[model samples]
Target: MRVVIALGGNALLRRGQLMSYENQLANIRTACDRLAPVAAEHELVIGHGNGPQVGLLALEGAAYTDVPAYPLDVLDAETQGMIGYLIELELGNRMPFDRPLATLLTMIEVDPRDPAFENPTKPIGPVYSQEDADQLAAEKNWVFKADGDQQRRVVPSPKPIQVFQLRQIRWLLEQGSIVICAGGGGIPTYYDEDHKLCGVEAVIDKDLASGLLAKEIGADLYVMATDADAAFVGWGTPEQKAIARAHPDTLMEQHRDEFAAGSMLPKVEAACQFARATGRRAGIGSLDGITDLVSGTGGTLISTEFDGVEYRD
Candidate 1:
Protein backbone atom coordinates (compact mmCIF):
# COMPACT_ATOMS: atom_id res chain seq x y z
CA MET A 1 0.00 0.00 0.00
CA ARG A 2 1.04 3.58 -0.55
CA VAL A 3 1.33 5.17 2.89
CA VAL A 4 2.18 8.60 4.16
CA ILE A 5 3.25 8.80 7.79
CA ALA A 6 3.57 12.08 9.65
CA LEU A 7 5.91 11.72 12.62
CA GLY A 8 5.01 13.90 15.56
CA GLY A 9 7.65 15.84 17.47
CA ASN A 10 7.36 13.52 20.45
CA ALA A 11 8.38 10.60 18.26
CA LEU A 12 11.72 12.32 17.62
CA LEU A 13 12.26 13.91 21.03
CA ARG A 14 10.48 12.52 24.04
CA ARG A 15 9.15 14.77 26.76
CA GLY A 16 11.48 15.77 29.66
CA GLN A 17 14.51 14.31 27.84
CA LEU A 18 17.57 16.43 27.23
CA MET A 19 17.68 17.50 23.57
CA SER A 20 21.04 15.90 22.96
CA TYR A 21 22.23 14.31 19.71
CA GLU A 22 22.55 10.97 21.48
CA ASN A 23 18.96 11.12 22.73
CA GLN A 24 17.70 12.02 19.26
CA LEU A 25 19.73 9.21 17.74
CA ALA A 26 18.33 6.74 20.27
CA ASN A 27 14.75 7.84 19.58
CA ILE A 28 15.10 7.74 15.78
CA ARG A 29 16.72 4.32 15.96
CA THR A 30 13.61 3.08 17.70
CA ALA A 31 11.44 4.81 15.13
CA CYS A 32 13.42 3.26 12.27
CA ASP A 33 13.21 -0.20 13.79
CA ARG A 34 9.44 0.07 13.82
CA LEU A 35 9.40 1.62 10.34
CA ALA A 36 11.63 -1.02 8.78
CA PRO A 37 8.85 -3.58 8.65
CA VAL A 38 6.50 -1.11 7.02
CA ALA A 39 9.18 0.04 4.60
CA ALA A 40 9.81 -3.56 3.69
CA GLU A 41 6.18 -4.09 2.77
CA HIS A 42 4.80 -0.82 1.48
CA GLU A 43 5.47 2.41 -0.40
CA LEU A 44 6.21 4.98 2.31
CA VAL A 45 6.32 8.76 2.37
CA ILE A 46 7.53 10.27 5.64
CA GLY A 47 6.97 13.73 7.04
CA HIS A 48 8.11 14.78 10.50
CA GLY A 49 7.79 17.64 12.97
CA ASN A 50 10.85 19.85 13.50
CA GLY A 51 9.65 22.25 16.20
CA PRO A 52 12.16 21.24 18.85
CA GLN A 53 15.00 20.99 16.36
CA VAL A 54 14.27 24.37 14.84
CA GLY A 55 13.90 25.91 18.29
CA LEU A 56 17.25 24.51 19.35
CA LEU A 57 18.93 25.93 16.24
CA ALA A 58 17.28 29.29 16.88
CA LEU A 59 18.56 29.27 20.45
CA GLU A 60 22.06 28.43 19.27
CA GLY A 61 21.94 31.16 16.64
CA ALA A 62 20.84 33.70 19.21
CA ALA A 63 23.95 32.89 21.25
CA TYR A 64 26.18 34.28 18.50
CA THR A 65 26.03 38.09 18.26
CA ASP A 66 28.11 38.25 15.09
CA VAL A 67 25.22 37.67 12.65
CA PRO A 68 21.47 38.05 13.03
CA ALA A 69 19.82 34.78 13.97
CA TYR A 70 18.71 32.81 10.92
CA PRO A 71 15.08 33.36 10.02
CA LEU A 72 12.54 30.69 10.96
CA ASP A 73 12.18 29.58 7.31
CA VAL A 74 15.95 29.07 7.01
CA LEU A 75 15.97 27.24 10.32
CA ASP A 76 13.04 25.16 9.10
CA ALA A 77 15.01 24.08 6.03
CA GLU A 78 18.06 23.36 8.15
CA THR A 79 16.10 21.11 10.50
CA GLN A 80 14.53 19.32 7.53
CA GLY A 81 18.01 18.60 6.16
CA MET A 82 19.46 17.80 9.57
CA ILE A 83 16.63 15.54 10.71
CA GLY A 84 16.07 14.06 7.28
CA TYR A 85 19.75 13.14 7.04
CA LEU A 86 19.54 11.33 10.35
CA ILE A 87 16.34 9.50 9.42
CA GLU A 88 17.70 8.53 6.00
CA LEU A 89 20.92 7.28 7.57
CA GLU A 90 19.14 5.27 10.22
CA LEU A 91 16.27 3.95 8.09
CA GLY A 92 18.61 3.15 5.22
CA ASN A 93 20.78 1.06 7.53
CA ARG A 94 17.78 -1.10 8.30
CA MET A 95 16.58 -1.43 4.72
CA PRO A 96 18.02 -3.31 1.75
CA PHE A 97 20.88 -1.49 0.06
CA ASP A 98 18.95 -1.37 -3.20
CA ARG A 99 16.00 0.52 -1.67
CA PRO A 100 16.60 4.25 -2.09
CA LEU A 101 15.85 7.12 0.31
CA ALA A 102 15.56 10.82 -0.45
CA THR A 103 14.82 13.96 1.57
CA LEU A 104 13.25 16.85 -0.31
CA LEU A 105 13.19 20.38 1.09
CA THR A 106 9.49 21.09 0.55
CA MET A 107 8.09 24.57 0.09
CA ILE A 108 4.42 25.24 0.82
CA GLU A 109 2.72 28.49 -0.09
CA VAL A 110 0.63 30.30 2.52
CA ASP A 111 -1.79 33.15 2.04
CA PRO A 112 -0.24 36.47 2.91
CA ARG A 113 -3.55 37.64 4.31
CA ASP A 114 -4.07 34.61 6.51
CA PRO A 115 -5.53 35.78 9.82
CA ALA A 116 -2.95 33.67 11.60
CA PHE A 117 -0.49 36.43 10.74
CA GLU A 118 -2.50 38.83 12.89
CA ASN A 119 -2.49 36.33 15.74
CA PRO A 120 0.83 34.64 16.39
CA THR A 121 0.00 31.62 18.49
CA LYS A 122 2.65 29.07 17.49
CA PRO A 123 5.51 29.20 20.00
CA ILE A 124 9.13 28.70 18.90
CA GLY A 125 12.63 28.89 20.40
CA PRO A 126 13.47 28.56 24.11
CA VAL A 127 11.52 29.75 27.08
CA TYR A 128 12.52 33.07 28.61
CA SER A 129 11.89 35.06 31.78
CA GLN A 130 9.35 37.89 31.51
CA GLU A 131 12.11 40.49 31.58
CA ASP A 132 14.12 38.69 28.93
CA ALA A 133 10.97 38.08 26.91
CA ASP A 134 10.14 41.76 26.89
CA GLN A 135 13.68 42.74 25.96
CA LEU A 136 13.85 40.27 23.10
CA ALA A 137 10.36 41.21 21.94
CA ALA A 138 11.45 44.84 21.73
CA GLU A 139 14.80 44.00 20.16
CA LYS A 140 13.54 41.64 17.49
CA ASN A 141 9.97 42.87 17.07
CA TRP A 142 8.87 39.37 17.95
CA VAL A 143 5.83 38.30 19.91
CA PHE A 144 5.84 36.39 23.17
CA LYS A 145 3.30 34.32 25.07
CA ALA A 146 3.31 32.63 28.45
CA ASP A 147 4.27 28.97 28.49
CA GLY A 148 3.66 27.77 32.00
CA ASP A 149 5.71 30.05 34.34
CA GLN A 150 8.09 30.90 31.48
CA GLN A 151 7.59 32.65 28.12
CA ARG A 152 8.31 31.65 24.50
CA ARG A 153 8.61 33.36 21.16
CA VAL A 154 5.36 33.16 19.21
CA VAL A 155 5.00 33.10 15.42
CA PRO A 156 2.07 33.01 13.05
CA SER A 157 1.01 29.49 12.07
CA PRO A 158 -0.36 29.99 8.58
CA LYS A 159 -2.37 27.38 6.77
CA PRO A 160 -0.61 25.72 3.83
CA ILE A 161 -2.31 26.62 0.56
CA GLN A 162 -0.12 24.85 -1.94
CA VAL A 163 2.69 22.36 -1.64
CA PHE A 164 5.17 23.47 -4.29
CA GLN A 165 7.20 20.28 -4.40
CA LEU A 166 4.35 17.83 -4.86
CA ARG A 167 5.47 16.76 -8.34
CA GLN A 168 9.03 16.18 -7.20
CA ILE A 169 7.86 14.21 -4.17
CA ARG A 170 5.54 12.08 -6.25
CA TRP A 171 8.28 11.39 -8.79
CA LEU A 172 10.60 10.23 -6.02
CA LEU A 173 7.92 7.98 -4.52
CA GLU A 174 7.19 6.47 -7.93
CA GLN A 175 10.86 5.57 -8.21
CA GLY A 176 10.40 3.36 -5.12
CA SER A 177 12.17 5.74 -2.81
CA ILE A 178 11.32 6.38 0.82
CA VAL A 179 10.96 10.16 0.65
CA ILE A 180 11.03 12.40 3.74
CA CYS A 181 9.80 15.90 3.03
CA ALA A 182 7.63 18.72 4.40
CA GLY A 183 9.30 18.88 7.79
CA GLY A 184 7.86 21.69 9.92
CA GLY A 185 5.22 22.32 7.26
CA GLY A 186 7.36 22.84 4.18
CA ILE A 187 9.22 26.08 4.94
CA PRO A 188 6.23 28.41 4.73
CA THR A 189 6.51 30.58 1.60
CA TYR A 190 4.41 33.03 -0.39
CA TYR A 191 4.49 35.40 -3.33
CA ASP A 192 5.70 38.93 -2.70
CA GLU A 193 4.09 42.14 -4.05
CA ASP A 194 6.07 41.67 -7.25
CA HIS A 195 4.82 38.09 -7.58
CA LYS A 196 8.25 36.78 -6.63
CA LEU A 197 8.22 33.85 -4.23
CA CYS A 198 9.73 34.43 -0.78
CA GLY A 199 9.79 32.73 2.58
CA VAL A 200 7.43 33.94 5.29
CA GLU A 201 8.17 34.49 8.95
CA ALA A 202 5.68 31.86 9.99
CA VAL A 203 5.19 28.19 10.68
CA ILE A 204 2.66 25.93 8.94
CA ASP A 205 0.75 23.32 10.88
CA LYS A 206 2.60 20.10 10.08
CA ASP A 207 -0.35 17.75 10.48
CA LEU A 208 -2.53 19.79 8.16
CA ALA A 209 0.24 20.09 5.63
CA SER A 210 0.91 16.38 5.77
CA GLY A 211 -2.75 15.65 5.27
CA LEU A 212 -2.71 17.80 2.17
CA LEU A 213 0.37 15.94 1.03
CA ALA A 214 -1.27 12.56 1.51
CA LYS A 215 -4.44 13.62 -0.23
CA GLU A 216 -2.59 15.17 -3.16
CA ILE A 217 -0.29 12.19 -3.52
CA GLY A 218 -3.23 9.74 -3.50
CA ALA A 219 -2.11 7.82 -0.45
CA ASP A 220 -4.15 4.79 0.51
CA LEU A 221 -3.43 5.32 4.20
CA TYR A 222 -2.18 8.37 6.05
CA VAL A 223 -1.05 7.67 9.58
CA MET A 224 0.05 10.28 12.08
CA ALA A 225 2.53 8.59 14.40
CA THR A 226 2.66 10.48 17.66
CA ASP A 227 3.28 10.00 21.38
CA ALA A 228 -0.39 9.15 21.94
CA ASP A 229 -1.43 5.60 21.21
CA ALA A 230 -4.91 6.67 20.22
CA ALA A 231 -7.30 9.58 20.21
CA PHE A 232 -9.14 9.61 23.52
CA VAL A 233 -12.30 11.19 24.74
CA GLY A 234 -12.51 12.61 28.29
CA TRP A 235 -8.71 12.73 28.44
CA GLY A 236 -6.96 12.97 31.81
CA THR A 237 -10.12 11.89 33.62
CA PRO A 238 -11.38 8.53 34.82
CA GLU A 239 -13.90 8.61 32.02
CA GLN A 240 -11.18 9.02 29.40
CA LYS A 241 -11.71 6.54 26.59
CA ALA A 242 -9.79 5.60 23.43
CA ILE A 243 -11.56 5.99 20.11
CA ALA A 244 -11.11 2.85 18.08
CA ARG A 245 -12.79 4.13 14.93
CA ALA A 246 -14.95 6.99 13.79
CA HIS A 247 -16.40 8.43 10.63
CA PRO A 248 -14.82 11.82 10.04
CA ASP A 249 -18.09 13.78 10.19
CA THR A 250 -19.34 11.74 13.11
CA LEU A 251 -16.15 12.34 15.04
CA MET A 252 -16.39 16.07 14.54
CA GLU A 253 -20.06 16.30 15.38
CA GLN A 254 -20.12 13.95 18.37
CA HIS A 255 -16.84 14.85 20.04
CA ARG A 256 -15.37 17.97 18.50
CA ASP A 257 -15.16 19.97 21.68
CA GLU A 258 -13.29 17.23 23.52
CA PHE A 259 -9.98 17.75 21.69
CA ALA A 260 -7.49 20.36 22.87
CA ALA A 261 -6.89 23.27 20.48
CA GLY A 262 -3.11 22.92 20.00
CA SER A 263 -2.85 19.19 20.33
CA MET A 264 -5.23 16.39 19.37
CA LEU A 265 -7.59 18.73 17.60
CA PRO A 266 -5.26 19.28 14.67
CA LYS A 267 -4.54 15.60 14.34
CA VAL A 268 -8.25 14.85 14.21
CA GLU A 269 -8.89 17.74 11.87
CA ALA A 270 -6.12 16.62 9.54
CA ALA A 271 -7.27 13.02 9.59
CA CYS A 272 -10.84 14.06 8.94
CA GLN A 273 -9.84 16.29 6.06
CA PHE A 274 -7.90 13.48 4.39
CA ALA A 275 -10.60 10.89 5.07
CA ARG A 276 -13.33 13.16 3.81
CA ALA A 277 -11.34 14.16 0.77
CA THR A 278 -10.01 10.77 -0.29
CA GLY A 279 -12.50 8.28 1.17
CA ARG A 280 -9.62 6.42 2.82
CA ARG A 281 -8.54 5.74 6.38
CA ALA A 282 -6.29 8.02 8.38
CA GLY A 283 -4.77 7.03 11.70
CA ILE A 284 -3.42 8.74 14.80
CA GLY A 285 -1.39 6.61 17.18
CA SER A 286 1.99 5.87 18.75
CA LEU A 287 4.87 5.33 16.34
CA ASP A 288 5.56 1.89 17.80
CA GLY A 289 2.27 0.53 16.42
CA ILE A 290 2.82 1.78 12.88
CA THR A 291 2.58 -1.64 11.23
CA ASP A 292 -0.76 -2.31 12.86
CA LEU A 293 -1.84 1.21 12.05
CA VAL A 294 -1.15 0.47 8.37
CA SER A 295 -3.19 -2.74 8.63
CA GLY A 296 -6.08 -0.78 10.18
CA THR A 297 -5.90 -2.78 13.39
CA GLY A 298 -4.22 -0.18 15.61
CA GLY A 299 -4.54 3.55 16.19
CA THR A 300 -7.66 5.71 15.96
CA LEU A 301 -8.77 5.17 12.39
CA ILE A 302 -10.81 7.95 10.82
CA SER A 303 -12.72 7.20 7.64
CA THR A 304 -16.08 7.48 5.94
CA GLU A 305 -16.25 3.69 6.07
CA PHE A 306 -16.67 3.66 9.84
CA ASP A 307 -20.28 3.68 11.07
CA GLY A 308 -19.62 6.00 13.99
CA VAL A 309 -17.34 6.50 16.91
CA GLU A 310 -16.38 3.34 18.79
CA TYR A 311 -14.40 3.27 22.07
CA ARG A 312 -11.67 0.82 22.97
CA ASP A 313 -11.51 -1.01 26.27
Candidate 2:
Protein backbone atom coordinates (compact mmCIF):
# COMPACT_ATOMS: atom_id res chain seq x y z
CA MET A 1 0.00 0.00 0.00
CA ARG A 2 1.12 3.56 -0.65
CA VAL A 3 1.63 5.32 2.65
CA VAL A 4 2.60 8.88 3.57
CA ILE A 5 4.25 9.18 6.98
CA ALA A 6 4.53 12.63 8.55
CA LEU A 7 7.27 12.89 11.16
CA GLY A 8 6.83 15.40 13.94
CA GLY A 9 9.66 17.79 14.76
CA ASN A 10 9.96 16.39 18.25
CA ALA A 11 10.81 13.02 16.72
CA LEU A 12 14.17 14.41 15.57
CA LEU A 13 14.83 16.88 18.40
CA ARG A 14 13.11 15.91 21.58
CA ARG A 15 11.86 18.78 23.71
CA GLY A 16 14.28 19.96 26.46
CA GLN A 17 17.20 18.02 24.92
CA LEU A 18 20.21 19.85 23.54
CA MET A 19 19.61 20.63 19.88
CA SER A 20 23.02 19.32 18.90
CA TYR A 21 23.79 17.94 15.45
CA GLU A 22 24.80 14.58 16.84
CA ASN A 23 21.59 14.29 18.85
CA GLN A 24 19.46 14.93 15.75
CA LEU A 25 21.40 12.37 13.75
CA ALA A 26 20.96 9.80 16.49
CA ASN A 27 17.22 10.43 16.58
CA ILE A 28 16.92 10.22 12.81
CA ARG A 29 18.87 6.97 12.81
CA THR A 30 16.49 5.54 15.38
CA ALA A 31 13.45 6.69 13.39
CA CYS A 32 14.96 5.27 10.21
CA ASP A 33 15.37 1.91 11.87
CA ARG A 34 11.63 1.89 12.53
CA LEU A 35 10.93 2.97 8.94
CA ALA A 36 13.44 0.77 7.10
CA PRO A 37 11.39 -2.41 7.21
CA VAL A 38 8.31 -0.60 5.99
CA ALA A 39 10.22 0.94 3.12
CA ALA A 40 11.46 -2.45 2.16
CA GLU A 41 7.94 -3.68 1.52
CA HIS A 42 5.78 -0.72 0.57
CA GLU A 43 5.65 2.54 -1.35
CA LEU A 44 6.56 5.19 1.24
CA VAL A 45 6.77 8.97 1.22
CA ILE A 46 8.15 10.87 4.21
CA GLY A 47 7.35 14.36 5.45
CA HIS A 48 8.98 16.01 8.46
CA GLY A 49 8.90 19.13 10.66
CA ASN A 50 11.66 21.67 11.34
CA GLY A 51 10.30 24.01 14.03
CA PRO A 52 13.24 23.76 16.39
CA GLN A 53 15.86 23.71 13.68
CA VAL A 54 14.46 26.73 11.87
CA GLY A 55 14.07 28.65 15.10
CA LEU A 56 17.64 27.85 16.08
CA LEU A 57 18.87 29.08 12.70
CA ALA A 58 16.95 32.31 13.13
CA LEU A 59 18.44 32.89 16.58
CA GLU A 60 21.93 32.28 15.24
CA GLY A 61 21.37 34.68 12.39
CA ALA A 62 19.98 37.33 14.73
CA ALA A 63 23.22 37.30 16.69
CA TYR A 64 25.14 38.44 13.63
CA THR A 65 25.22 42.21 13.18
CA ASP A 66 26.11 42.37 9.48
CA VAL A 67 23.55 40.53 7.36
CA PRO A 68 19.84 40.60 8.02
CA ALA A 69 18.42 37.34 9.26
CA TYR A 70 16.98 35.07 6.61
CA PRO A 71 13.20 34.77 6.38
CA LEU A 72 11.23 31.74 7.48
CA ASP A 73 10.78 30.61 3.88
CA VAL A 74 14.54 30.26 3.36
CA LEU A 75 14.91 28.60 6.73
CA ASP A 76 12.12 26.18 5.81
CA ALA A 77 13.96 25.18 2.63
CA GLU A 78 17.22 24.78 4.50
CA THR A 79 15.67 22.53 7.14
CA GLN A 80 13.89 20.49 4.48
CA GLY A 81 17.19 19.78 2.77
CA MET A 82 18.97 19.23 6.08
CA ILE A 83 16.43 16.88 7.60
CA GLY A 84 15.79 15.10 4.29
CA TYR A 85 19.52 14.42 3.93
CA LEU A 86 19.75 12.92 7.39
CA ILE A 87 16.61 10.82 6.87
CA GLU A 88 17.69 9.46 3.47
CA LEU A 89 21.21 8.73 4.63
CA GLU A 90 20.15 6.92 7.79
CA LEU A 91 17.24 5.12 6.11
CA GLY A 92 19.48 3.90 3.25
CA ASN A 93 22.04 2.54 5.69
CA ARG A 94 19.38 0.41 7.36
CA MET A 95 17.89 -0.97 4.15
CA PRO A 96 19.46 -2.97 1.29
CA PHE A 97 22.09 -1.11 -0.69
CA ASP A 98 19.90 -1.17 -3.81
CA ARG A 99 16.90 0.72 -2.36
CA PRO A 100 17.06 4.19 -3.86
CA LEU A 101 16.04 7.35 -1.92
CA ALA A 102 15.28 10.86 -3.09
CA THR A 103 14.34 14.17 -1.43
CA LEU A 104 12.47 16.74 -3.49
CA LEU A 105 12.41 20.45 -2.62
CA THR A 106 8.66 20.50 -2.89
CA MET A 107 6.58 23.70 -3.02
CA ILE A 108 3.00 24.22 -1.82
CA GLU A 109 0.76 27.12 -2.70
CA VAL A 110 -1.43 29.00 -0.17
CA ASP A 111 -4.02 31.69 -0.55
CA PRO A 112 -2.71 35.18 0.05
CA ARG A 113 -5.91 36.10 1.82
CA ASP A 114 -5.55 33.37 4.43
CA PRO A 115 -6.61 34.69 7.85
CA ALA A 116 -3.72 32.98 9.55
CA PHE A 117 -1.50 35.78 8.35
CA GLU A 118 -3.57 38.30 10.30
CA ASN A 119 -3.07 36.20 13.42
CA PRO A 120 0.10 34.22 13.92
CA THR A 121 -0.70 31.09 15.89
CA LYS A 122 2.01 28.64 14.85
CA PRO A 123 4.80 28.46 17.41
CA ILE A 124 8.42 28.34 16.28
CA GLY A 125 11.88 28.53 17.80
CA PRO A 126 12.97 27.91 21.37
CA VAL A 127 11.10 28.47 24.54
CA TYR A 128 11.85 31.52 26.66
CA SER A 129 10.87 32.89 30.03
CA GLN A 130 8.27 35.65 30.03
CA GLU A 131 10.91 38.28 30.72
CA ASP A 132 13.25 37.07 28.03
CA ALA A 133 10.40 36.66 25.58
CA ASP A 134 9.17 40.17 26.19
CA GLN A 135 12.70 41.58 25.78
CA LEU A 136 13.15 39.74 22.50
CA ALA A 137 9.79 40.95 21.32
CA ALA A 138 10.74 44.52 22.12
CA GLU A 139 14.14 44.24 20.43
CA LYS A 140 13.21 42.26 17.34
CA ASN A 141 9.61 43.39 16.77
CA TRP A 142 8.60 39.74 16.96
CA VAL A 143 5.37 38.22 18.17
CA PHE A 144 5.30 35.96 21.19
CA LYS A 145 2.73 33.58 22.57
CA ALA A 146 2.35 31.68 25.80
CA ASP A 147 3.25 28.02 25.44
CA GLY A 148 2.38 26.21 28.63
CA ASP A 149 4.37 28.11 31.26
CA GLN A 150 6.76 29.75 28.84
CA GLN A 151 6.66 31.92 25.75
CA ARG A 152 7.71 31.02 22.23
CA ARG A 153 7.66 32.72 18.88
CA VAL A 154 4.45 32.41 16.87
CA VAL A 155 4.13 32.89 13.13
CA PRO A 156 1.25 32.78 10.74
CA SER A 157 0.71 29.33 9.30
CA PRO A 158 -1.51 29.61 6.27
CA LYS A 159 -3.43 26.64 4.97
CA PRO A 160 -1.89 24.78 2.06
CA ILE A 161 -4.08 25.03 -1.05
CA GLN A 162 -2.13 23.07 -3.64
CA VAL A 163 1.01 20.99 -4.01
CA PHE A 164 3.36 21.41 -6.95
CA GLN A 165 5.39 18.59 -8.52
CA LEU A 166 3.09 15.92 -7.06
CA ARG A 167 3.24 14.01 -10.31
CA GLN A 168 7.00 13.74 -9.96
CA ILE A 169 6.57 12.30 -6.50
CA ARG A 170 4.13 9.73 -7.85
CA TRP A 171 6.57 8.88 -10.63
CA LEU A 172 9.38 8.40 -8.15
CA LEU A 173 7.24 6.14 -5.96
CA GLU A 174 6.34 4.09 -9.04
CA GLN A 175 10.05 3.65 -9.68
CA GLY A 176 10.41 1.96 -6.27
CA SER A 177 12.11 4.88 -4.55
CA ILE A 178 11.44 6.21 -1.09
CA VAL A 179 10.79 9.92 -1.44
CA ILE A 180 11.14 12.49 1.35
CA CYS A 181 9.52 15.75 0.47
CA ALA A 182 7.34 18.55 1.94
CA GLY A 183 9.58 19.23 4.85
CA GLY A 184 8.51 22.26 6.93
CA GLY A 185 5.35 22.35 4.85
CA GLY A 186 6.71 22.75 1.30
CA ILE A 187 8.34 26.21 1.47
CA PRO A 188 5.11 28.22 2.09
CA THR A 189 4.71 29.97 -1.26
CA TYR A 190 1.92 31.89 -2.99
CA TYR A 191 1.32 34.29 -5.85
CA ASP A 192 2.02 37.90 -4.99
CA GLU A 193 0.11 41.07 -5.90
CA ASP A 194 2.15 41.27 -9.10
CA HIS A 195 1.00 37.81 -10.20
CA LYS A 196 4.34 36.02 -9.66
CA LEU A 197 4.64 33.08 -7.34
CA CYS A 198 6.79 33.90 -4.29
CA GLY A 199 7.72 32.57 -0.90
CA VAL A 200 5.95 34.09 2.10
CA GLU A 201 7.05 34.98 5.61
CA ALA A 202 4.96 32.19 7.06
CA VAL A 203 5.05 28.55 8.05
CA ILE A 204 2.61 25.84 6.98
CA ASP A 205 1.49 22.97 9.21
CA LYS A 206 3.42 19.90 8.04
CA ASP A 207 0.79 17.41 9.21
CA LEU A 208 -1.96 19.22 7.33
CA ALA A 209 0.26 19.46 4.27
CA SER A 210 1.06 15.75 4.52
CA GLY A 211 -2.64 14.90 4.71
CA LEU A 212 -3.31 16.97 1.61
CA LEU A 213 -0.38 15.31 -0.07
CA ALA A 214 -1.68 11.90 0.90
CA LYS A 215 -5.08 12.68 -0.54
CA GLU A 216 -3.65 14.17 -3.72
CA ILE A 217 -1.29 11.26 -4.22
CA GLY A 218 -4.04 8.71 -3.56
CA ALA A 219 -2.31 7.07 -0.62
CA ASP A 220 -4.01 3.99 0.76
CA LEU A 221 -3.16 4.98 4.32
CA TYR A 222 -1.82 8.05 6.09
CA VAL A 223 0.35 7.79 9.19
CA MET A 224 1.33 10.76 11.35
CA ALA A 225 4.23 9.74 13.53
CA THR A 226 4.59 12.00 16.55
CA ASP A 227 6.22 11.89 19.97
CA ALA A 228 3.03 10.63 21.59
CA ASP A 229 2.29 6.91 21.94
CA ALA A 230 -1.32 7.31 20.82
CA ALA A 231 -4.20 9.78 20.67
CA PHE A 232 -5.74 9.99 24.13
CA VAL A 233 -8.64 11.80 25.75
CA GLY A 234 -8.30 13.49 29.17
CA TRP A 235 -4.63 13.29 28.23
CA GLY A 236 -2.93 14.20 31.46
CA THR A 237 -5.44 13.67 34.24
CA PRO A 238 -6.70 10.73 36.28
CA GLU A 239 -9.40 9.86 33.74
CA GLN A 240 -6.94 9.64 30.85
CA LYS A 241 -7.47 6.72 28.51
CA ALA A 242 -5.83 5.53 25.32
CA ILE A 243 -7.84 5.42 22.12
CA ALA A 244 -6.52 2.49 20.14
CA ARG A 245 -8.91 2.79 17.23
CA ALA A 246 -12.11 4.61 16.30
CA HIS A 247 -14.04 6.34 13.58
CA PRO A 248 -12.76 9.88 13.03
CA ASP A 249 -16.15 11.47 13.52
CA THR A 250 -16.65 9.82 16.86
CA LEU A 251 -13.31 11.03 18.13
CA MET A 252 -13.87 14.52 16.84
CA GLU A 253 -17.21 14.86 18.54
CA GLN A 254 -16.41 13.10 21.80
CA HIS A 255 -12.78 13.98 22.39
CA ARG A 256 -12.40 17.48 21.08
CA ASP A 257 -10.38 18.82 24.01
CA GLU A 258 -7.97 15.89 23.91
CA PHE A 259 -6.09 17.33 20.95
CA ALA A 260 -3.75 20.08 22.06
CA ALA A 261 -3.12 23.00 19.74
CA GLY A 262 0.65 22.83 19.31
CA SER A 263 1.03 19.10 19.52
CA MET A 264 -1.52 16.42 18.64
CA LEU A 265 -4.16 18.79 17.29
CA PRO A 266 -2.83 18.97 13.76
CA LYS A 267 -2.08 15.27 13.60
CA VAL A 268 -5.59 14.26 14.63
CA GLU A 269 -7.19 16.83 12.35
CA ALA A 270 -4.96 15.72 9.49
CA ALA A 271 -5.73 12.08 10.04
CA CYS A 272 -9.43 12.83 10.12
CA GLN A 273 -9.20 14.82 6.90
CA PHE A 274 -7.48 11.98 5.07
CA ALA A 275 -9.84 9.40 6.53
CA ARG A 276 -12.90 11.37 5.47
CA ALA A 277 -11.46 12.34 2.11
CA THR A 278 -10.68 8.83 0.86
CA GLY A 279 -12.58 6.59 3.26
CA ARG A 280 -9.24 5.14 4.41
CA ARG A 281 -7.65 4.79 7.79
CA ALA A 282 -5.02 7.16 9.17
CA GLY A 283 -2.90 6.30 12.18
CA ILE A 284 -1.42 8.64 14.77
CA GLY A 285 1.10 7.23 17.17
CA SER A 286 4.69 7.01 18.39
CA LEU A 287 7.50 6.60 15.88
CA ASP A 288 8.66 3.54 17.78
CA GLY A 289 5.31 1.88 17.15
CA ILE A 290 5.21 2.58 13.40
CA THR A 291 5.40 -1.02 12.21
CA ASP A 292 2.67 -2.09 14.59
CA LEU A 293 0.59 0.94 13.70
CA VAL A 294 0.65 -0.09 10.06
CA SER A 295 -0.38 -3.62 10.99
CA GLY A 296 -3.31 -2.43 13.16
CA THR A 297 -1.52 -3.72 16.22
CA GLY A 298 -0.90 -0.26 17.71
CA GLY A 299 -1.65 3.46 17.48
CA THR A 300 -4.94 5.34 17.27
CA LEU A 301 -6.46 4.43 13.94
CA ILE A 302 -8.86 7.08 12.59
CA SER A 303 -11.40 5.54 10.25
CA THR A 304 -14.54 6.68 8.44
CA GLU A 305 -16.79 3.77 9.45
CA PHE A 306 -18.45 4.06 12.84
CA ASP A 307 -16.95 1.79 15.45
CA GLY A 308 -16.16 1.69 19.14
CA VAL A 309 -12.61 2.47 20.22
CA GLU A 310 -10.40 -0.51 21.00
CA TYR A 311 -9.19 0.34 24.47
CA ARG A 312 -6.51 -1.32 26.55
CA ASP A 313 -7.63 -2.92 29.78
In the range 1-313, model 2's lDDT, one tens digit per residue, is 9999999887799887788999999999889989988888889999998888988988998999799999889989999999999998899898888889999998999998999999998888889999999999999988999999999999999999999979999999989999999998889999888989998888899999999999999999899998788988877898888888888787788787777887788888999889989999899999999999888788889887748566644
lDDT of 1 by residue, 27-118 (tens): 99999999999999999999998877888887788789999888889999998998999999999999999999999999999999999999
The whole-model lDDT of each prediction reads 0.91, 0.90
What pairs collide in candidate 1?
none
Best by TM-score: 2
Best-matching candidate per lDDT:
1
The weakest ten consecutive residues by lDDT in model 1 span 120-129
After superposition on all C-alphas, the RMSD of every candidate to the true structure, in Å, is 1.7, 1.3
- Candidate 1's C-alpha runs over 4 A off are 126-141, 146-150
